[model samples]
Target: MAGAETTRDPYAGKSPAAPLWTADFRFFFTARTTSLLGDAMLPVAITAAVLHAGYGASGVGYALAALVAPFAALIIFGGVLSDRFGARLLMVVSDAARLVFQLVLALLFLLGTPALWQILALLALVGAGSAVFQPGVASVTPRVARDVQKANATLRVSESVTLVLGPSLAGLLLAVSSPAAVVALDALTYGVSGVCLLLLRAVPMGPGPERDGAPSFRADLVEGWREFTARTWLWSVIVVFMLWQLAGAGPATTLGNSTLVTDYGSSTFGLVMSAFGAGSVLGGLVAIRLRPRYPLRAGALSMTVWALMPLGVALGLAAPLVAVCYGISGVGGAFWIVMFHTSVQTHVPQEVLGRVHAYDAAGSLVMKPVGQAAAGPLAGVAGTVPLLFVSSAMAVVTCVLLLALPAVRGLTRAER
Candidate 1:
């Protein structure tokens, strides 16, 4: 049903307007970009707040984990609900919930020192909201845009811009005002995003007939699993990403941060990350222009670049050199994301798309915390440099194996 042509063109036979000019898409873009801005600011503000409140690094870690762990745990349920009730409704509910929690947290922050547990609890609620928000947002796009590729590219470009600017804006705000102010602003943005969702008039109710008599929760999950596992290419790439992410997360995040701070300084590390974000912008721009014949192949090949960041670090390269590598990886990562999402939207049936996406996200990220948890101990035992090298090599190997799979390399784009 995803790629299938219907008698009714959702765009209503009008000539394709620029993605930004399409009313529904325009609203969606504005909402997402505004929300991303807040998300980008949140980590910095929260970390600073925790430290200022006299919590140590471990407190920061637990606080961050509280946000991510529940997000991963509940995402599959979110997907099922999105497919069941409709993306629009789920998005509205999710944003509203987030808005309430963020406002509460901001108020608490303003009142004085809040306990660590209170902060973690609030963050966990926000994360639960995200679990619903993500699938709803992703699943709604195909319905809103006539040209999925261009739409995705446009969205990625907006996200890239947000990533490039949000943290810098947060830092400046923190320098002048307080973390409470930043969080209050974030709460305000969530309210804005909720209003935008209410304004969106054209998003489809997912998987029409199948959703008529909604199955039991367990049955819905089982059906989603069947859809996810039915496609060879889909599962293969997901598996590859799980392995690749598992290998890279620790090295890129924990080790990279530690090594850079020790060898260079926080400023240099920030510059390197900024370069990576810039590369993602470049990649999104390039994706808008290039329509690869074999999208899956292209995406898989692009992933080979991911190995370079760890390799550069393993070689004990200078910060600028390692930054260059990170930049390249960012480009590849952006390309892969655009292509991968497009492929899935095209190939997967619309009714089950949200569930499949949830599975994809869950599988890809389920191991990240494990990798983060293991990285420190592993580094202690095996040494950081060697662990980084091993991760780099594993990344390359994973890319090669994915490319070698007939299912991955041979899949073509679905007809529009």
Candidate 2:
């Protein structure tokens, strides 16, 4: 049903954004933006809350770990769950649950119970919501776009826009009230997202087994694992990213946050992130217009720009260099994501798309906790500058390693 022509496939030539404005894309795009904006608020808010509670680097590290650990543990299961239930309904429920979780934090703050432990718990719960929502959206993309590339570009653009808007808005909001206000606003965004998700018509999930048999949890894990390992590029990229996440992207953002925002005393951490988002928006728009010759190789090559980010920070080129590095990384990351996603969607069978995507999420996220866990102590010993340089070098190494994998390097665009 995925590539097959049917009533679901529109015969008339139309731009991708057209459907997004009219139907499935509009609802999902709104939902995606709202959720992303809220998510962008989380790190800044969490860091502020921890500082307010008089917690040191260790406490902040733990808080960050709590936010990502669940994705490592539950993302594969999240995919399986989305497949078992309806993706649309699951998405709606996840958004609503997240709203409840954010509201809990707001209430806690209002009650003066803004302890580090409570913040940690709230972050974990919010992470769980992310675990569910991401796979749901990934699983449903085939149902919306006529072309895989269009679908990939559309989703990336929507995400990039949200990333840009979320943190910028969060920064401004943080100036006016306590971090709790950001959480409350996050809750409202989720509520609005839930409402929009509820209004969408039925989304058809492609063929799979009747699912008459209830598999054990371990069995489901094994099944997802088998599905994951079978793909050469998928698992290969996962392996590279394991090192990459552990060594690079994770610490660069989280630990670097402490250095840039806390130590440097810049009120522009959110703005820096927004610059990254802006670059992503540019990349997405470029992806929409420019078809790549070698998506896999190009993606990896684009990621080399990440090496410059740490160099900028290490040199203390905060305003100008940070902005430049972020814009480059954003563009590169956006293109990389589109290539990665389009490859998966085009190559993987739709029946197992959700589970496979879950597998990807689970594997990629597994290192997030490792990085988060190690960031604080490591930064404490290594100092932020050394870690920044080391992480940047590691990212370059990882990108090079990705190029060595035939599955990734040989990948090209699918026939439209």
Candidate 3:
């Protein structure tokens, strides 16, 4: 299954002969960009409010756990529902629901102090919406754009832009206004995205109908799982990705950020992050033009760049040196994301793409929180530097070894 190629796209001849940015694709792109912009701004405002209002550090942890819980729990269900109802329909509904939740949370912050549980519940609502929205978008992109690679690159560039702007905008607003304003602004973006999602007319190719008279949800889940596992290259890379995520996400992202701030100071940390953002933008722009033929293999190679982050920290590099390493990794990350998504969109059949994406999301994320939760305690015993070293080794080894198989090595882009 790894080297398998489809003879024809299901939606062949449907793509417009014009450039990538057709009317419907533009609307779809706008919807995703606006949503990401809001998501980018959200964490800073939430953290500021939680800390400033005396929710304390534990409250932030609790908030993240609350958000992750429902998202993980409902993500598969979201995929099934999206497949049944159509991507645009599900996305619009999800956005509308998130919009309401954000508005309510904003009102609570503006008017009175909501209990921690209440805030968590609202955040969970948002996460659920996110879970539902993600798979649909993955399924929808190939349908929306004539060139999936460029489309994915454009989205990644928008993400890079928002990464620079979102936090800055939130910080600026917090200086002059309240967290409620930030949350309200996020709600407004959701409204805009929802309206845009509702307007998409390009993707008439929805998912297949039910298997029998009334297929159980469990049956659908099984079918998706079978499809996912049918491709060894797909599952093998996922297992490798899961391992690296387990190692890097918590230890590298959660604990590593803390270490950077402690050792180099906030200013240095900001500089390093800014470099990463700039690199991501550059990567996205380059990827728009440089569409690699063997996207899956190239993408896997790019992910190995993440090893530099932990390696830089473990070696006690200077602030600028660490920044440069992370910046390179950021470029690699954008390239990897664009290539990976494009490969999935081009290779996977349209009917089951949503469900498969859900599994992909689940596999990639399932260990991240566990890693986050365990990193602090584990580091206390092993020390952060040693664990950082381990994380780097795991990334390099997993990727390099996976390349030995022909399945991973030989896979190419679908014929247009």
lDDT of each: 0.82, 0.75, 0.81
lDDT of 1 at 77: 96
Candidate 1: tens digits of C-alpha lDDT, residues 285-383: 888888898888887788778778778877888888989998998888888889988888878877788899999999989877778778888899999
Judge candidate 1 at residue 25 and give its lDDT. 85
Better of 2 and 3 by TM-score: 3
Better of 1 and 2 by TM-score: 1
Per-residue error for 22 in candidate 3, Å, reads: 0.7
Each candidate structure's TM-score, on Cα atoms with residue i matched to residue i, is 0.94, 0.83, 0.93
For residue 294, give model 3's deviation from the true position in Å: 1.7
Regions of candidate 1 where Cα sits further than 4 Å from its true position: 1-9, 12-20, 204-210
Q: Distance from true position, residue 316, model 2, in Å?
A: 4.9
Candidate 3 residue lDDT tens string, 1-416: 22232323344676433378878888998898899898888888888777766799999878767766888888888887776667778888899999999899899889878889889999999999988988898878887777888888999999998998889888998999988888888889999999988787766434434322436778767767878888777777778777777886568886778889999999988888888898899889978988677887887788788788778988989999999888888888899888877877777776667788898888888888788778889999999899889877876786686687678767887733
Model 2: weakest 10-residue lDDT segment is: 2-11
State the lDDT at 161 in candidate 3.
88
Candidate 2 overall lDDT versus native: 0.75
Best candidate, lDDT: 1
1 or 2, greater by lDDT: 1
| Cα deviation of 351, candidate 3, in Å | 1.1
